[model samples]
Target chain A: MDIFNGIASGFEVVFQPNNLLYCLIGVVIGMLIGVLPGLGTVATISVLLPITFGLPPETAIIMIAGIFYGAQYGGTITSVLLRLPGEASAVVTTFDGYQMARRGRAGAALGIAAIGSFIGGTLAIVGLSLLAPVVAAFALDFGPPEYAVLALAGILLVSSFGSGSAWKCIVSATIGLLMASVGRDLFTGVDRFTLDSPQLADGIDFAALVMGLFGLGEVLYDLERRIKGNSAPTPKVKNAWITGTDWVQSRMAIARGTLIGFILGVLPGGGATLSSMVSYAAEKRAAKDPSRFGKGAIEGVAGPESANNAAATSSFIPLLTLGIPANATMAIIYGALLLQGIAPGPQLISEHPDVFWGVIDSMWIGNILLLIMSIPLVRLFIKILQVRASIMAPITVMIILIGAYSVRNSIFDLWIVIAFGLLGFLMKKFGFEPGPLVLAFVLGNLLETSFRQSLQLLDGSLFGFFARPISGTLLVLMIAVPFLVMAVRLFLRKRVAQTDLQKEYENA
Target chain B: MGVPTRRSQDTATQSEEVGVVEADVDDEAVTPAGAWSHLVAGGVPLAFGVVMMLGSINLGLGSPTSPQPGLWPFALSVLLIALSIGLLVGRGRFGPCESFGSGTLTVIAGVGSIAAFTILLPLIGFEIPAIVLAAFWLKILGQESWRVVAMVPILCTAAFHLLFVEGLGVAIPHLFSF
Candidate 1:
């Protein structure tokens, strides 16, 4: 379909009352989670997953996507008000956002951030609409070999770029693959790891695992530490509108941030956090007086805010077109899609046009909703932040436990949730990332299927993967990434060591 | 997407620490007890890998031409073992292992409550277990006020009952099945 028709139809999907309502709910929940520090989008989405079980696939995705991007907006409220970032992406915003608040220009800073985020997110949607179909069409001809290589590269890139050590990420992913191997083997119809248990026969439940690992696990971890309530006085918003000078100063920064965020967001492992930091640095560098950055500069708030929202939106490109999640949040969304029986990939646009377009279109509406509601809702969201974590944590755990049981109405699933929850807590304590494990679990079957199929098609020759143009390129890139990272690290280390040597000589 | 070089691991740890503070819980800070902790952490995956390898051997490792189910798992097991060894070898670089301290007791209580809920829910229904779990957490772990500890559980349980059972019609085992 053409871009114009796709967008028009997308609007039609978004206009449905059900989709619109869910979109609103999603954003509201997203904002709430974003404003609250302990509960992240990942856990929130996991806990809420069962609620979407009865909805149509398109509505389910639209709502979940809303939560993902709407969070980018919600995070700014805390950063500007309390100098405490409610979300990881909002960390940089606290620099100038809090400064502006202290200077009694809090309203102006927030207003500019909201405006910039709207523009950035909307622009990214347009870019997604224009680019997604082309990429999907290009990948339409990917054979088993290409898919195998792509999946391998995808897993590797996510692990290497993820929050933990590459080896740990790999181990987590390997464990996920092993978990996916449980139940009856697809190819052989033989039980690989079920251990004669009836529940194990069907394989481990995804919803149960997620709720346990992310939801309950989070609760346990939070139990280990005390959460201090916010003592910062709420900044009064006397004037929420930015002056004409503020607009002129921030317009270019917003545009640059949008562009930077969009480009970076499409890369595997690149998301809101990276984009925000880079945009802030970029704005600082481009400014005539860089010294104004940490001192209530509107550009500082505008740039990173725009960049994060834009990055959040554009990160969908990989998940939608390539079937590879760009970051941890996208990985959860990918699982949601799979639960809805939709496998996201190059064929998704062709196979599920309504779902594909509806999600993208709803993003435009979600942004509009955020822009309209953020100002009015800021006070309400701030009130949510004041709620004590002690009260919230157990309630969240109960919800997760019950939610886990709700899926398939099995008590065995509850046990699974508890088990994985404990495992997740220990993993966190020991510094292992659950994101890669989840991502790997979601992609495990696909990876294995592609690998075996590629081998079969290539007459059992491993070199067959390298014979194809696309697959070969992907394999080469995968092989090169680790070496490249190692080289960069080595160079950086040498530079630091040399600098220290120079300091020592000077001191002597 | 914004910055090319910012590591996500750093962001995750920062957010987690932030969450801890926001929750108003005082943590007993202690450094990881060096090699022993590292050994424990790394040993887990190594143990699992060893068990998996042993299991796969019984399943028969078929050739590449027409692979068996065990072949793929065996490959991953080998990878897991290798990574675990690497982790042990470079344990110092991974950072200080955090001692659970006083929080360990809280974790134990929390987990115990969940286990109690699971065992009791099927037999006695969800209401009592739910209330008890909430109250335990509030009073004991959270150290909430007696008034709050008394009131919140009943209110939360009522709300959840309405939402999950009455409104959504989820098939939770309640005291009154109707």
Candidate 2:
């Protein structure tokens, strides 16, 4: 009955006028950002982080959560109409979605994608609502040793599963941990890396670092591309209604997608992009005519769209329950929660029950808003894209600078943002995925404090960590995950290659 | 004393074990920059690690039981150095990063403008610098026509003023009041 009570309270919180308004605003911004190619969810969230500070934690999270899932469906519009994937997860949508558009079934494709997204998102919310409390309850028994090990394992998983080399990702993570170590040491009261600045005592502002990396950094990197200007013409959207056949075909695809997406989204690094890709493949295999897979197959669009949306919703489970960010974007949300003075771990359900239930329940509301708005606003979103890059460049830069200053009303944060901006740009240029770095940085202090406390219990024996049942099991699993993943991936690649060869032989 | 010594040794080995699990992917992001960019990338972290370590040691590495403030950071600094070394040894084989090219000047100008804005903000309040920065981005960076360049800065600055200063009553200093 605690679950029911929590749900009831969540509805009470979300239905408030202030929260409802913010939710509407968030979904709109999310749709626009999703439609735009140059900017992404991470950059958008970073820009808005400062603005969220003034709002209540529950309201802030509700808005942010709305933006996240709204962006998932926004990408589908561009994919079907313009053959451009607005988000990484939407890449698979462009394949059959664009083909459907070319075949003059654009309306059918769009309508089905919207419907599929709704089902997938709604189902994922149900899963999150059911699963989050259970996970939180299970994690309540965890001590410092378990926390320290869990934090390390989380970062390790993100790095190993990231797009870049494991070495580079880990190295990036190390830098984040190192940065987290700056300022005075709490235990001994000794200054570590303050560089003699009094303001450094409290450590670096999370807002400044993130705004620099994701916001200004993306702006700087995308500067050249903006100069060239966008060349794609907006396609007209019409008759956004699907046929019975289309719905029949898409229903099963959406169901399978929801399942695939929910499972992957719970993992440390398997987020929307990976889940969407997996769902697309699964749909293709299940199809009666595999040849129709890429050439305007409605299931192709339905499955991946559903999967991406579902994954987007379910990825919140880790952060809300375990206080471990599942992906890069979640890392920023985690930072936002911390800045709100709301600690996100097992105690969150009891300590900040309003915020917890409110965020989850808000997703249900946000998804409905996305479905209602996305189809009608297709032209408006396309028009938003037509606005010259010149207009956006100054505005984005201005917001970033002003936002940085808002952190503590300090001029120093402006400089800090610029420095991290340059560093972030360089890292991106060098193919370093900033996700692991951000995740590691967010978790670094938590890991450190827990580790130091755990050491007292271990009796000064470093080996005692692995000798304990919980920490030891976690560490062993941490070691095993990368190897197991690599082996499975290798096996799959070989099997696919053989399958391709056999298909070629049969065709010949 | 012996316990502290043994703990440090154990931590080092454990770090190395983590390091050895360097499972690589076929990364598509990096273009073939010369070893120079790779060297710079590797060397920055290495230098950063060394500097942090020196400071950490100065902070004092207490026993695991006692756990000084620097102990965790100090351990991390060592790990940082090892990882950077591994990166340097990579010789651009894993993912050779992109070198700075034609876009360097644009970035430099962007950074330079941001720096100028930061300096001018507290000195002259936010209006003049805001106008100047907006104009530079829209005109110089954006390469828009004179009409757009003339109109956007003042209007945009006014909107920000309305939102932040008037609506929210943020503590930022501004030259004008309504």
Candidate 3:
């Protein structure tokens, strides 16, 4: 009854004119960011963070969340038509989607993907509605020790499950922690790394840091491999629709994908990209004829598409309930929420129920919007791919500088953006992911706070962390899961198209 | 823990972009020079960690129970030093390390002009710097034609002035109020 009441209230919030309009704008922008290769959701959101400062907290979160999920739909457009995946999650779709397109079933491939994404996203939102409160309820009992372990687990999960080097992820995390350690200490009221700069006393601007790293850094990196001036040959994608046979064939795949995506997405570091890969493998294994995959199989497109959307939706569980972001993009959202002065924790459901339920319910609306807009917008999305990076690069850089400056009306913020931009560029060149660094930085203050608190509670023995039931269990599992996963991976040496998946993430 | 090395297969996998922006990440990312990049990457962090660690020590790290201002940072600095050392001793590409290519000059140029824009903005107003930076990028970085380079930057800067200043009232220091 409470859940239904909550849902009804959520609907009322979402159905408001301004809220609906913001949601619409959010998805459209999300679709644009998704269709464009290289300028990822993280970077786009980073640049937009400053702009969101003016909006109401729920609307800001709703719009940002729409961009996050709308991207799932937008990415599939390029994969089916041009054999180029606009986002990492869409990489697996290219394996079969392009083939399907080559066979003149581009419409069908896209049609099924849209339907699958809609079904998967909607189901995951429903699951999130049901499950997030339970998880939040369970986590409400968590103490400082539990929070410390959970934060550690969150960072570790991001580093381990994320693509590229785990060592680098750790290194990236340390740098982020270092960055977070800047500004005056909240506990003792002493400057740590402000270097006597009055601007840094408040800490490096979050908007500036992210814009430099993800936005400017990405642009500078792209200079090495600049976008071609030539426009793409017009893709001939007519209005796509799924046939009854196509639906029958892919229905089970979508169902299975929904389950896989939901489960993986709820776990730390298990995001849309990971779920899509797992779902593809699951579909391949469950297939009556395995050879049908990677050769224009509708199931290939269906399973991964569904799974990724589901995962994207379900990944919200950890962040909303526990205040632990599951991935880089989630970290940015977590920061956005923090900047809005709304701490994301177990108390979020009670303290900010409208924000909590509003975000959850908005996904339902965003998903429906994506389904309705997918076929109509495919041509426009493809046309956007032709916009040369040269034209957009400087404009984007200008936007970043302005966005950073806009944050606090400080010129120093502009310097911060460029400085971090250089660092971001160098980071990418070195294979150190900026994702973990940003995640760590955003969470750094909380981690340090909980850590100090936990230690005091433990009487500084530190081993007392392992004495508590919940924190101790979590710590043990965090330590054990890597080895368990490694053993499983080694036992099952039958590697799926996992390298290709990693390749896409690296691209992203 | 078995640490990761930049394997030869990773080089193969670096071919991420296929159609338009084909990632030109060749052996350049993992060359003999790349090894030095590894040193720079590791050494910079290590040095920062040691300095910060010393600073934290000076800040008076209390015992774990009675923590001081520097305690948390001290822990982080120590962790940083440890990770940096691992990065140094670890063989092969520790992560996605790239050798600065020819385009790095383009970045340098772009950043340099932007820096000029920042420095000159408050002193000489945002308009001139914005126009200059935009023009430099369009003409030099983008290699646009004389006509485009001539027209776009002025138009773009005027557009920015209108949007941020006149339209939005952002309070960016500008030359003319109107």
Candidate 4:
């Protein structure tokens, strides 16, 4: 009854005219950007973050949440229609989705994906609505030490399991921590890395850093390679309907995918791409005739589509409940929340119930809008894919530069954008992921402050962290995971080598 | 004749699409030529960490019981140095280095124009610098036609002026100071 009441009040917030309008705008923009190849959700969100600076926090988050899930649905369109995947999560869809499209069932494939996404997304929201409050309540008693450990574990998990090598990720995160220390020390009033510049006194602007790293940085990297135009003929969708058998086959797959997606989505480094991959593989393994997969099986489309959407919806759990982002997009949203002066944590639900619940309720409305609009808007989105990156790149760059300047009307921030843009480009060139860096930057101050507070509270005993049950377990896991991974790798290598030697002896 | 040639060009671009896809996937990692590149890449961060650690010592690293301003940063710098060393000795490769391809010049031009715009904005205001940046990107980097190169920057600049300045009342520096 409390959950229902909470959700009902959430719906009341979403029904506000401006909130509804921004939801529509967010989805439309999400779909348009998702239709384009090189422009990703991160870049799009970073570019649009400036616009949200002028709006209410709830409205801003509602629109952003819409963009997040809407892009998940939009990504399916390109994967099914073209062999090209619009987003990383859509990659698995290309195997079966394209085949179904080639067999003249593009409409059915799209229809199934939309339905599955709606089901899965709605289910995940139910899970989030029920689970988020409990988790936040549990975390309410977490002291500075627990927060410090959790933040450390979070950074380590993201960096280790994220896109790049663990060392590279750790180094990137360390740099972020150092960068966050650039301003005046809150307690001591000593400027750490300001280089005697007055502008650096307030520390680096979060907006400027994000705009440069994600927006302009992406544009610069994209310029290195030419954008290839899609030549695949758009599949005709004569029937925008699924057959009875299609529903029968996919019903279980959808259920399985939603569960798989939600669990994976809750983990720090686990995301839509990993969940979708797992779901598709699980569907194939579960099928009576696995050979039919990649040859126009409806279950393939249903499973991954459901899984990715579910993952996207549930990824908000850690962010909304724990004050930690699970991935890059969540990190950007985390920054957006911080920009709005809202510290997202356990207290957020009790403190800013409107933003927390409004965002959750908006996801349901957003999915409904996507389900209704995506099929009709497919043709329009395909046209968006035809726009050359040469034209789009400069425009995006211009927007990023202008947006950075608009943050504080300071030229210094513009220089910061350019500087970080160059740094981000180089980082990408060196195979370093910017995701960990951004995540660490957002959580850097929190991590440092909590670490200091814990030390102060514990009277400078480094071993005091282990005295607490929760922080100790987390700290142990943080230390153990990397060594565990290394040990496993070493064991596997030795086994393989021994086997190779035995094979040589047998041949002799 | 024009139609046939244009169609052929389109097909050529289409044929290159698979390569672009492969390149995008492979763009995540590139095998370095040798340990030298890794050394250089890893060394920069190592040197930065060492310098910062020295600076932190000067800034004062207090006892854990009574921590100073430099304590956290000093610890982080040491960790950074350790990680950099790990990277240097580790067998992993690095880099997705920018090829000296056709777009290299375009990228340089793009960066140059942005830097120029940053310097010029405070001096002359936004309109002229914005127009110049747009013109450079469109004409030089994008290689749009002369007509487009001339028209788009003016229209885009004027539209930006109206939107950011007149509409939103954002305090962007302007020539007229309105």
Candidate 5:
């Protein structure tokens, strides 16, 4: 009865006339961001963050969360239709999705992806509902050092998730960590790298950095390929509906992917990428013909798509229950919470059960709403994509400028966005991935505070980082994992080279 | 185990070629226009972080009880520098201009317009400056139609003003007409 009471209360809060409108607006913007090739959910959330400065904390957060998940639904559309992933998690889906499109199964592929996402999302909501309170209770005991270690561990783990060349990942992560240091020293008050520019006194805005890196950077990269006159051939989309056989084949993959994704998502620092990769591998291993995986197998598309959505849903457990964000995107959401004055630790559930439960409850409503909106609009979105970037570019630039200016009504911030946009374009050209940079920027403030607090608590002895069990264990793992990955990569490389040599010898 | 193997196999044929092509692409992406000036494009955050770091010197940015003021900015600056270095080096290693023509113009145009808009925004208020900025940017970027140029700035300015100011109660600073 009380649970029912709680649900009713949640509905009352979320379905408020204004809140409902905000939720609808949030999803629409989220879908637009996800459908666009360069923009992602993080950028959209950050850009809109300042606008939420006046709303109720709960309403603002619910709407933002709605945007985050809504984008997940829209991300698949681009990956399937254009072979261009709007979000990182959708990268894997593109493999099978584009293939299926090529084979005239775009409808079936789109159908399964949508249905699977809904199922996974609904399941994750149920899981979160059951687990949040218990997890929150446990997280109450954590302190500053624990938080510091958690953030550090997240950065390390995320770096490892980068594709290709562990060294590149390491270097990229290190650069991110270093870029995090660009502003005033939180400990000493000494400017380390500002070089006398008055504009940098506040340090880098995570919003501007992400907007530049992802949005501007991608534009530059795309321009390069486009100017070469290699226009993307618009594939003729076939019946975008799911058939009975398609459903029968995809049911198992979706189920398995959802389960796998939710579990992996519970871990820190790995969400869409980890879940999709794991699901892809699982689907391939279980497939009758594994080769079909890269060639448009329904299982391939369904499993990874389901896994990505499920993982995106489950990533909330750590945030809601433990007050921890395992990656950059979640870190931004955490920032949103902080702005709302809603501290997300162990006490959140009992202290603010309505907020927690309402948000959780809203996820279901939001997903269902997204399903209703997205299915009918899939074709419309596909048509929207056909609007040449050249045409859309101007509109986007206007939106970015207006969005930037509206935040704090500050011209300074708009200028900042513009400057960062250029930086982003350049960075993309240079092969530096912006993901780690944005992640670093988000973690920058926390890492500094946490490190300094730990130092202060331990009287400046570095040993304190290792003295705490949780911190110590995590640090050791962070140190060990990199070396292990490096060694393994080297060993494999050596082995491969030896095999090639042996083959040459045999030919001789 | 298989992931790495499969990845390597996928890239095996093209890894070396990819490296070479990537270097050429990098150069194309950043040529006479794309060079270190591109680094200045990042000057906002770099400068912002520096100013914040400097302010912490005396402001007691972080308290001794929790965290000192200088702690966050210092860390942020270091991260910014490392990232910048990585970007610079990564670009340098790759080179430019084998494929795309003077792509750095996009970077320059984007950064220039944004900076110019910021300077003009406070002077003219939201609508005129925003419209001019948007129209100028659109025209420069190749959208020539008056409708394409005119509609975006006017509509966006109104939409933003309504959403942020009227609807949301966000304070919007208008230079001239309310």
Candidate 6:
């Protein structure tokens, strides 16, 4: 009943003309960019961030939030129609959706994606509304040790999950931390790694690093493939419309995905990419026709689409309640909040209910708007997908260059983008996963700073990490979960191999 | 098309051709070989991390009231070196086979475009360099007709200038500013 009142208040804020307009605009832009390969939320958000400086912080936050989730919905379009996923989470969608498309069921695939995203996003918001208050209350009792443990657990899980190779993930995360170290030491007048460059004193901007790694690097990878003739025109779409049976098949898939996504989204370091993967695996396991899964099952499209949207929505809880950013995008949102001079903590809800409630209300509104807008535009989006690499390749690269230059009006940033672009290309060539590197880069500074701060609280000892029960439990979970997964995988593989050998021996 | 390898049946045939074109110097380490190249990549970061740890020991570690300078970096670097060693021992058992195809044109165009942009940025300013870079890149990538060349630059520069400069308020260094 109390939560219902909060929801009512949230609706009142979201219903305002300005907030509603911004939400609509955000979703439209999110869809457009998401439809375009090599253009993601990070680039769009970063480019548009400076403009939000003039608007009401609440409105700006609402609009940006709209773009974030809207993009998730939009990303499914290309994945289903063209087998090209605009975002990482949508990668799983391409498996089944593209197969469906080849089977001339593009319409059904698109419909399932849209409907699933709406269901998932809405349910996750409900989870946020109900669960955030409880979680915030629980987090209120946390001290430095608990915070330390949470940060470490976040880094360990994020880096490990981000990088397919555990060692690579660790190294990339470490590199992120080192890059964060390039400023004037807060306590001493001594500079650590500035190398006498005055600009280095302030340290590297996370935006610049993100742009370098994701934005520029991605375009360069595209360029190399195109030039090598490996990126010829992909299969084009004739239609992207859904049929009646799609809704019936997708209802349970959407519901299940939303639930799975909500739980994962609530956990620190659990996000859209991971949720989508798990949802895909779950759907496959539960499907009566498991063999049809990778061959264009409608449930596959519905499940992951729902999961990603739900995960995207739930990621906001930690930021609003505890001032903890579980990922880079949320961290940037935190930065934007800081610029508004709004300190996110226990007092935030009571003190700034409008900002909090307005955002919550707008997320629901944004999801509706995106679903309505994207459904009709599915064919149009597919048409844009037909835009050849020749046209997109140059334009994407130029945008990268200009984005790098515009950040500080410095040419040096352009060089940084170029350097990172080449590095990204080489990494792609060698099968080095770039997602972990980017995620680690984003979380690198926060992890190191918090870890060190916790140590200092305990007079430089690891015991502090284990002193807090929550921290200790989280650490134990972090160490245990990966090993358990590994062991399970090994056991399953061994069993299968043994069975195969036995069959062969008997036949011989 | 040459005869697709047996390995091509399970894997995407596209990347396989690129792989065959490359000299397989360490073929044994290539397939299911592990993370040798990953281990090699870890070396630079590990060394960087070791330096930071040593540097932090020389500096004061900040406490609760006052944050220390080297504290975060030092600890992170130590983590880096540890991870690097872990990667070497755990992942360095194998390497990826390099591609041997002639991607020289792509490499040149891709790398050249950036170099040109950097050199041109301070001289001709953002608009011209961006347009030129866009045109050149598109051309090199095989969209060389005048329509593509003309339309792409005009649209790209106009849209970029509008979104970034006018809309976002990111100041563009004008041609004469340099």
User: Which candidate leads in lDDT?
Assistant: 3
Q: Spell out the clash pairs found in candidate 2.
A: none
Each model's TM-score for chain A is 0.93, 0.94, 0.97, 0.92, 0.83, 0.84
Candidates 2 and 4 compared: the better one by TM-score is 2
Q: Indicate whether candidate 2 or candidate 5 has the larger DockQ.
A: 2
Best by TM-score: 3
lDDT of 1 by residue, A1-508 (tens): 4778878888899999999999999998888777765677888898888888889999998999999888888888878987667666777787899899999998888899899999999999999999999999998899888888877777787787655567777888889888888888889998988889989887898888888888888778777765534433467876457899999999999999999899878867636765776788788879999889789999999998999998999999989998988777788888888888899999898788899999999998999999987766566566565555676787788889888888888899999999999998888777777878888887888888989988899999999888888998888988887676557445534422334322222111
**Which pairs in model 4 have colliding backbones?**
none
Clashing pairs in 6: A107-A241, A107-A242, B21-B100, B22-B99, B22-B100, B62-B68
Measured against the true structure, the TM-scores of the candidates, in listed sequence, are 0.92, 0.91, 0.93, 0.90, 0.78, 0.82
Off by over 4 Å in 2: A487-508, B1-31
TM-score of chain A of 1: 0.93
* Whole-model lDDT per candidate: 0.80, 0.80, 0.81, 0.79, 0.64, 0.67
For candidate 2, lDDT tens digit of each residue in A1-508?
Answer: 8998999899999999999999988988888777764567888888888899999999999988888888887878877876656677777787799899888888888888888999999999999999999999999988989999999988998898766678888989988998888877766677768889988887887889888988888888877433333335445667678898998988999999999999888878747876777788788789998888778999999998999899999999989998988888888889999988988998999999999999999988988888888666555555554444456677788888887787689998998899999988888878687778888989988988888888898887778889888889989999998887677446534423334322222111
C-alpha positional error of residue A404 in candidate 4 after TM-score superposition, expressed in Å: 0.7
Off by over 4 Å in 3: A484-493, B1-33, B145-155
Model 3 lDDT tens row, A159-247:
88677788888888888988998998888889877889988998888889999999999888877555533234435778678789999
Model 6, position A409, has a per-residue lDDT of 78
Cα lDDT tens digits for candidate 4, A1-508: 6668788889999999999999999988787677765677887898888888998999999998888888888888878887667677777787788899999889889889989999999999999999999999999989999999888888887887665566788889898888888898886888887888999997888888988888888888777654533444566665456889889999999999999899878877647876786788788879999888879899999998999999999999999999989888898899999999999999998899899999999998998899888767665555555444555666677678777888888999999999998888777766577888888889888998999999999999989999999889889988887675456335534422334322222111
Query: Candidate 2 or 5, higher lDDT?
Result: 2
**Which stretches in model 4 have alpha-carbon errors above 4 Å?**
A228-240, A476-508, B1-35, B91-102, B145-151, B175-178
The window of 10 residues in a row where model 4 chain A has the poorest summed lDDT is A499-508
Q: Model 5: per-residue lDDT, tens digit, B22-118? A: 2232234223345554354344335544655565454444544455545454555555555445544554342231223554465466556667766
Evaluated on CA atoms against the true complex, candidate 5 attains a DockQ of 0.16
Worst 10 residues of 3 chain A by lDDT: A226-235
- As a TM-score, model 2 comes out at 0.91
How much RMSD separates candidate 1 from the native structure? 6.8
DockQ comparisons of all candidates to the true complex: 0.35, 0.24, 0.29, 0.35, 0.16, 0.26
